[model samples]
Target: MRWWQCRLAAAVALLAAVLALGAAGPRSPAPLRFAPGGRFKLALFADLHYGENAWTDWGPAQDDASDRVMAAVLDAENPDFVVYLGDLVTANNVPVANASLYWDRAISPARRRGVPWSTVFGNHDDMPFEWPPEWFSPAGVPPVHCPPAASAMPEPDPGCIFRGTPRVELMTAELDRACGLSRSSVGPRELWPGVSNYVLQVLSHEKPHDPALLMYFLDSGGGSYPEVVSCAQVTWFHSQSRFLNPDGRIPELVFWHVPSTAYVKVAPKATSEVRKPCVGSLNEEDVAPQVAEWGMMDALAHRPSVKAIFVGHNHGLDWCCPYEKLWLCFARHTGHGGYGDWPRGARIVEVAEKKHFSVNSWIRMENGSTHSHVTLSSARFS
Candidate 1:
């Protein structure tokens, strides 16, 4: 039998064993790889805004709808990995002390299916609590409750209500969960206040040992801090790329929540005919960028190996347009919580395990319809 056939059989048998055992909880992640046919699929669940208004039926209902969307996508695509592409919860709206509870629910579908996953923080993930205006009204619930879970808050809101879970604590909780496949990291100390900055390697289906792809996650700051990828983060990226891919051979893809100013640079004008080269159905809002661009884009632009940057801030936009050497793409809004009545869905990325790989992405709607396909590669442009 051929080597690929052997790998396929092994993967199938392992999956069968896992099904027999049942997904009581996370099983250990086998080594990450594309399917034996040299294809790998990744599902991106973005702007879930999971914990919004937990006290209200509307909030929980939205979460349930989001859960259905994810379950549908997972069943349809059967991705190799999953990425919670930011805004896991609207922390300002989340009354709970530990927001990780909501964050955990956001990635639960992938966990049950035994797919490895990771996350990056969005502006809402750790925003300080904003009291409901109704609380100050005559018919309001008294604003006397203090969060029992949040501790050592560096800065608190007016009432000393829970400041949302800091990035460190959120990422740390996932690491502690023993979820087995949560590749989320708190990132480097030098880049403090910017947790969720880390990298993950997806091994080649052929070599099985060598990393064929490098996926980098950066903390594009928001919430309490300005929504900017700091110069320090750029420096860190330079160091990591130098050490990991000095030759710029392996392909790299980046993930964060907010778009950099570079996105605004390439965005198709919001008003006019709104046609492609940029292929997306919706363009509801202008690019909501970080407060500043302090060199992260330049660094990625200079690197030929950097194929694309995936982000999730704009629920209205889900298109991949070229930005210098790479593509700037917005993941489709996956949660019903965010400000969109449009169809809920996840963005799926597929990569080929070839010497010169092409990364393709499309939006898979909750109704099981897929659209907006684009290839993020120089060859496509050529």
Candidate 2:
């Protein structure tokens, strides 16, 4: 073959290869926008401390009533999905049989609805004491003593660290048993398995064009259970953010059992004898640090991808937007199904493709007799 013929053939082969490569290149994701007149809704209920003895006055009947109410509400709403924020059952000193029963009843409604549901660990659900700590207790360790009263503790215990008020002692003991931790001390491992605190990335089947939403469910076991999320969780979070290719976007939602931060009131000094606010009292401006150790607030504060944080435990209606751009919502508890002045309630949230959404909360009154609804709309985002 001639030299010119060989060179021409080589050039043609290279050109063909380049064209094929171009055709296989990745395509840009479509811009997410809410379908005009398209309504997407999901029901959210938390703190459904279901089980025997959960309520003071009623037992099985109350449980059944609560379950009925929840089922009825879901049927009425016909939402796309249901999310139980946590505290599915109250585990304090309760037998595993009771816990299982309550959980069965509580979840029955969602199951009957045949809708998908997901959960994050709440202080009550899956925390050590919900089950017998003996099963989880380390061999050769002596059981820790439960303090008698709040005054006996040397320091202020957040969430009743000592004396186990409102059954904290019993819960702590159970947690100790579950984690196979030495009763001599409770640490992080017994509470959060795998990494202490970690993020779960959920890709939306509905909105494939949007970035995968990351839900960072922190293990706020507090003094009751060992700190599960350690420095590693924080470090991994930072690293993950760096390489995240949400198609140039951030997570659309974040779900955790505890609030990123909370506000507490501090006392003013009276002429000289200054006293800090009483321990255990809610502070107006205090924010609970993430990981229970070290500072990750700065990392979360700077992450623009985080759209909103959903938390449960307060069992009341509250909203906080600490950062000008972020939204914090507290979901109401579903356990009030039996007792308590607080009505049993749940939230329904609608998310749009354009980063716009609306939240509506429903409360069951007269012991699941009727439901009252409240709706809140977010300032549109893109």
Candidate 3:
């Protein structure tokens, strides 16, 4: 072949390679931007508790009711994003596959609306029903379960239990396949093992990667395990927060399933004069822990940019209470599959992109009534 022909063929091959790379290039996760006028509204639907009972009519009926509640809120709010604050399914009572079915039902509303959403694991999320109920232990006592070696026994020993995949695996896989919405953009690695602990950045209008506001999702351990945010999880939060906001100029909001110890303190007086009745339950059993100061609450308190922390473990307790400089708020229980017969609703968080970052929140019931409106600003924080 002539030298010119050889050069021409090489050039064509290089061009083809470049085109292929461009076509199959990685799609960067789209950053959630502020809406016009710097306003972004997020709907938090907590404790959807899908698949409360797999083999019973009563459980399915409740799931349908919960579906109605989710549909109503999605239609009413039309939020930019939605966060499912854990307890997505009562996994312990149902098989792993059936539990995933419930996870699908719960996220359908958001998926249909084209709204981006994320989730943080609740205590009961991935718990195997095989684990004994008594293992959760009575008040103030940590759960005592069979040792890890017992899981290796081949025979059906009453004392031996089998744990296959981690609880978050199937649901995370289903979400990745079905809706492609609930998967975390943050970590599936050892740094945040066995849970969904990640961060989502709300970018500014001016810059692509420049974050205006941050959203942190942590896994507060639960189910066969005790309901506590481990020290390692707290360390992960601090590490991620520093990486995301080096100068601490950006504001943030944290989401998880279980409420903190400070929650009990502010919950009693949490009511809105402008909104309707705050009807719900707040028993001692619903609270997470005051037995030990885990430093998560204190860590948040020390961070000036952390505006508030939101949770949804107690299906009955829904209120926004002031704790330290930040607000510890409960998402109005929106599930019928769980223990409550109270009115179901979701919490709406609106963050403004003004000179100083500020926030306003309220509850929207299935009937479209708005309640518990509160505004948090630098002025209020101090």
lDDT of each: 0.85, 0.48, 0.73
lDDT of 3 by residue, 145-193 (tens): 3323312346554532333235556445555644445535435566444
lDDT of 2: 0.48
Clashes of 2: 27
Task: Give the alpha carbon lDDT tens digit for every residue of 1-382 in model 1.
Answer: 9999999999999999888789566555566776788878889999999878776778889989989999999999999889998899999988776787787778778888888899998999999878889877988864343344434446654443355778888887777763688888889999978998998888888888888889999988888688999999999999999998899988899999999999999898874444667777778789999999899999999999999999998988888888776888999999999797988888999999776687888999999999888887764463
For each candidate, give its TM-score against the true structure: 0.87, 0.56, 0.79
- Provide the lowest-lDDT 10-residue window in model 3: 271-280
Candidate 2, residue 209: lDDT:
53
Each model's total of backbone clashes: 1, 27, 1
lDDT measured at residue 81 in model 1 versus the true structure, 0 to 100: 88
Task: Single out the weakest 10-residue window by summed lDDT for candidate 1.
Answer: 142-151
After superposing candidate 2, which stretches have Cα over 4 Å from the reference? 1-40, 52-57, 127-214, 222-229, 239-248, 263-293, 320-324, 337-339, 354-382
Rank the candidate models, highest lDDT first. Answer: 1, 3, 2
Name the regions of candidate 1 deviating beyond 4 angstroms: 1-30, 142-161, 271-274, 380-382
Superior by lDDT: candidate 2 or candidate 3: 3
Query: Considering TM-score, where higher is better, how would the candidates rank from best to worst?
Result: 1, 3, 2
Tens digits of per-residue lDDT for model 2, 1-382? 8999999999999999999889987443233233344444556777776653532345445667667657766876676556666566665633332243345456667666565444555555544343334546665323332223323346554322211122233334333232221111122352334212434343454565544344455544433454334455567566666666434264445555655443211222212331221111111223333345444455664666655566666664433333434455555556654224455656556554334444444443324343334333344322
lDDT of 3 at 33: 90
